[model samples]
Target: MNFKNFGSQKYLLSEKMSGFSSLAHCFTTREGGFSTGKIQGLNLGFRVGDTPEDVTKNYRQVCDDMGFSFDNMVLSRQEHTDNIRIVTEEDKGKGLTKESDIFETDGLITNLKNVPLGIFYADCVPVLLYDREKQVIGAIHSGWRGTVMGISAKAVEIFKEKFGSEVKDIVCAIGPCIGPCCFEVQEDVAQHFDSEYVLKKENGRFNIDLWKANVDILASAGVPRENIDIAEECTKCKNQIYYSYRAHGKEHTGRMCAFIELKD
Candidate 1:
């Protein structure tokens, strides 16, 4: 991950995706925004008790820093399902300047230039996809439910079906989220994952590796392993730099955004 800052606001760009000049992407950190009090610093989530005005200001700062207009950015509602929406020129400003018509979508994809796809997360894995050859991009919010449902892998298929993109031409970046180190689950939740990715502890609890689980899903879908980049930062472990729903509780925690746009 490439750490960058514009004034007090800090963000990250994936090492693999940053090499391309055809796209602009950012994974925002919880720093430098108009938000204050309980949910301080770059709180992009409008539903998390933050004012729409403050959230818009936060989005504007990030859009300006990335050299794209916030008006052209499109965001998902993210209901923890595997639903991925293929955005177009008409979808621009859907969840921002305009009232959102999108419903229960966990992912957003687009081939349109200057139309940035955005997804918000606290600890849920945020996956950004780019088809360098086809000029297509995707942003997915893969929480444990979405992961088990194979949203990341489904995204690879979306690239092929929607934009004539080859699996080999698509690259993915899995951003920071709650890691196995702190993500303890019970038998009900642990039963959903493959045993190869689960660690059963002596206390009868389990630790599931969401990062590796997502990697396997993408690779299984034929996205080249070498084309994937994992941030490997655990939001729970590094709560100072990012928000963690488990650490701060959902009501008090803010969300970080994974946003991408095909350069116009």
Candidate 2:
């Protein structure tokens, strides 16, 4: 991942995805927006108790920085399920300029041009998928629950089923999230993953590596290892740059937006 500065706004771009000329993707940081106080900086989440007006301005700021119109963005209403929605041009501006028609969708896929798929995150993993051959793109919000449900693999299935996208033609980028170094979980959470991905720490706690788990899931779904890029950024460790729900709590933390679009 590489840092990109557009005036006061800062975002991360995947080096692998940057080679594609027909795509626009970014993982935003907590910088350059109209939000204030606890939700200061770029708070892109509408349901996180931030003022709707502030969020609207934040969207405009990020859109301006990314050179895309806020009106063409479709935001996900994440429910941590493996549910995937295939968006179209008609779904543009949902959950942004208007109320979202889609709900309980943790992942979104689209072959539509110029309609950006947006997913909010603080600590959860952000996975972006693009099929060069099919001109399809996807954005996923995978928390531990979503990862356990194999939402990343589900997106790959959608790409294949809906657009005839071959797994070999797809490129994936896993963005920043709560890393295994800081994501300690109880037995219930740890039970779903394999022992190889879980680190048994002291006091019956386990550190679950969502990054590697998702990578394995994608690989199982047929995406090549050489085509995947893991940002390896821990939200808890870098709480100052990215929001960390564990570090700052829900009341004090704001959400970042991981967005991707298939250019016209």
Candidate 3:
């Protein structure tokens, strides 16, 4: 992930998809915001204990840096499930008002211009989808459970099933998250994934590779391997630039958002 420094706010972008003009997307970091202490900067998760005013300020800062209206964002209340919502103009500002109580999905997609879709994640994987030929975009929150359920692949499937988008025409960016280096797992969880990529040990513990598993899932669903850009940054190991619920124990931590929208 390439850190984009735009004076007041800093965010991350994929180098591979930098040339896609119609796609406006970003993976926000824990920098350049008004909050203090645990929720230091750019925390988008309202349920993370940050004051509503501070959360609003953080949202505005990120949107201002990206040149998108904060009011146009459709935020999803991620449940770590495979539920993916198809967002429209009517869903705008769902997270900022009464509609905020209505979002129950872990993923969001839209073909509408100026309507940004956002998914919040701390240590969970953030996936961005863009269908160049169909002008469709999707944002997904895939944690270990979601990955086990193949939510990344399911998001692509939902896009194609609903919008008639070709999986080959979609470019995916797997944003920064808890990398395998720090994402140690138990044997029970390891049993849920394919052993081809997961490494088992004599101690009965496992070093599960969630990234490869999701990539494989996407490929199986027809997304080319070369079209996926995986961010090398690991959230658990790089807590200075990210908030890790696992690394931080039960401490109140902020969230990073993966946002995408079709440019008008």
**Cα RMSD to the true fold for all candidates:** 0.9, 1.0, 1.5
lDDT for model 1: 0.90
Local distance difference test, each candidate: 0.90, 0.90, 0.83
Q: Residue 150 in model 1: shift from native, Å?
A: 0.5
Model 1 clashing residue pairs (backbone): none
Tens digits of per-residue lDDT for model 1, 141-203: 999999999999898898998789999998999998999898899999999999987999999
Please tell me which model should have the higher TM-score, number 1 or number 3: 1
Order candidates by TM-score, high to low.
1, 2, 3
- Clashes counted in candidate 1 amount to 0
Question: How badly does each model clash, as a count of residue pairs?
Answer: 0, 0, 0
Taking the tens digit of each residue's C-alpha lDDT, what string does model 2 give over 17-84? 99777989999999788889887888998888899999888888888777665787898788888899
Off by over 4 Å in 2: none
Estimated TM-score for each candidate: 0.98, 0.98, 0.95
Worst 10 residues of 1 by lDDT: 67-76
